[model samples]
Target chain A: MSTGGGEAEFEAALREAFERRGREAPAAAGLLEAVLARRRRQTRHRVAGAAVATALVAAGTLLGAQLLRGGEPAGPAAGVPAPGIFAAEEIELCLLPGGGDPAEVLLSAEVGGEEVQTAISEPAGDAFRLHVERAPGYTVRLDVLRGSVAGEPLDGARDVRAGDRPGRIGDAPGGGRVLLLETGTEGVLLRLTAEGTGPGDAELLAWAAKITVSTGRDACES
Target chain B: MEFDDYVLTRGDALLRFAHVLCNDAQRAEDLVQEALVRCHRRWRRIEHGGLDAYVRKAILRQYLSWRRRRSAEEGPAGDLPCAGGAPDQGIEAIGERDAMWRLLAGLPRRQRAVLVLRYYEDLPDAEIAGLLNCSAATVRVHAARGLARLRRHPELTGRAEVVEDA
Candidate 1:
């Protein structure tokens, strides 16, 4: 996995994957246009204090510079929205391994944002997110349970000042960095910034603290 | 790099990238059309900077930055086109390719883009850094992690990327 000197085999394999995907997936002029339209309208986060790419990225899905105050995500909140309501037809969710079972889960939501999208995936999946981004910039991601500071359950979840002060969240008691982040649909954001850490390290810690996961329910669709 | 020329020349590449990111045809078109309009809006600034490169950077970044809409986001009645078997399955192995995309859809954003630029777009680390606004090392990290995961994929078993030991 070393991104070192000329590795044709590795590079070729990468190309092959995309080529294979392109051929398998239907290709049309309009599909490209949809991506264009979406990308054009998406917003960018203004990054401060170098060391990372501070782009807000895609609508309400903005990346923040906050460090995980420290801890893991709280246990699933009860009386939460059904996983089905979260599922969308056209949208697919790629669940990467952050020390969890089903190593990787690739799921598609049903589109309406009312139903939850669900699907199982093989373990040993890698890191990368390839899918359409259509969520608005101002969404209040209401997860019944856990969402680490690293995770973006609530769209953008930043920009607007938090009406309620930031507090602690995590299920496993006694000092984990998990907290149930809550914000209105107006782009209230939460970010975990691991001070004096690299992006990868920070991301790992963040995932540990905040990864929206479903341990009990296998699959659901509304 | 004028807006007019970009639409004419690099539009195809943009469309192609959009298609890959989205895995759907019609949606890809709408994405590009919107990207084109935005590019045209900033045509003057882009021409001075580097039209194709700017548009490309913007497009890729935009793709990453936009709010992710799930299939559910499409109206209750309207669904994002579902993936179906291609008619030309005989000509091309559709399932295999779909498997690859399915695999890709599982990854996080930065890793996906890094892989796209390094392998698909064939841009070096420095250029990728320029595009992603990160250090060269970060780009290398992303490329490495992304490739490692790709190699682990079974379909990619004989694709010539995985080392025997790897």
Candidate 2:
């Protein structure tokens, strides 16, 4: 082929390749279903978030009024620990694609207070595990799962509250306590597992209160 | 048009366009899904006309700004399967086409996008610039650079020389 002819042939090949690839695109089956499902989830989250915000505002207003009136503020209520007592660190975990089945750890830090030594974050299938070693034998493991609860049953799970977040506390199989808290992000939950006999409900609740989970707004944001 | 009807009718075409833009099946689906989700929210306002154009623009913008999770060392997935038979149907012709496809894959995202829009979509430079949110001059520059890179490949040039000798 002449040079001009060769160039023309190359262009034709490129165009033809694009056309073929376009034809080879897979059927967009379940696309509408997926979009609708996502929209529903987002709507649910927005409603729940609005409710929580309204409740917080009301409670804050009541407490402020009492304090301004010179009335003694109520002591720490049982089960509901005082907020901001523990130095909480917000850890942002970026969820992987495909429903974030296997999330990537964007950040990790010392959770709870100085009593907790260090936090080790690892990507577990369908869950992001954050291991906090309180002492030699006492380790607190928190697994963040996106979009669903862990395999543990919620039948006998007790309702627990950490700050404004509501969750369920249950006994983990194989001898441990598990606290599942709903991370503010839609469909993301933090499964706090207390392995070893060292920490009980009090310690677990404290740790849960101190640690905050945030879905990072970068990689999967779009 | 109703959202469901629109999706059922044009969803396949959007998927194909996204596939051409991103060159990855999974990523293409994601791009289309995201664009549809955004459009679904405002379908009431845009349903009368230009809805297809709106969704296509959304897909293109997302593809351009997408931060790939994979490490930089990894390249895009391999090229799509062979389209069909070429005119010459010779070994050299096949080699050149394959080499050109790989070179196209390696171009910078913007340049690749420019070439795809100009050639595959048969868009003018101004239209492509409007989609890409850049000036027509910039679109021309990207297309020129991309075509120049493809033309300079040794495999294409050498294979052309071989075909000429024959």
- True-structure RMSD, every candidate: 15.7, 14.7
Give me the runs in candidate 1 sitting further than 4 Å from their true place: A1-7, A20-222, B69-92, B158-166
Native interface contacts kept by each candidate, as a fraction: 0.19, 0.33
Model 1 chain A worst lDDT window (10 residues):
A54-63
Docking category of candidate 1? incorrect
Model 2, range A63-146, lDDT digits (tens) per residue?
333432236543232123222222233333344434544435433332231112222245456576654445445456657666
List lDDT for all candidates, in order.
Answer: 0.44, 0.61
Q: In model 2, where do residues sit more than 4 Å from their true spots?
A: A1-7, A45-222, B68-98, B156-166
Across A1-222, the per-residue lDDT of candidate 1 in tens digits comes to: 334432665565558666655544433334434444444444221123111222212111221223332243322331122122222212233433334322334444333312243333432222122222222321122222123344533322222211132333332232222223332212222222211111222222222222232322222111
In model 2, state the lDDT of residue B154.
79
Q: Per-prediction TM-score, please?
A: 0.45, 0.50
Q: Write down the DockQ of candidate 1.
A: 0.15
Q: Pick the candidate with the highest lDDT.
A: 2
lDDT of 1 by residue, B22-52 (tens): 6666555545555565566456655565665
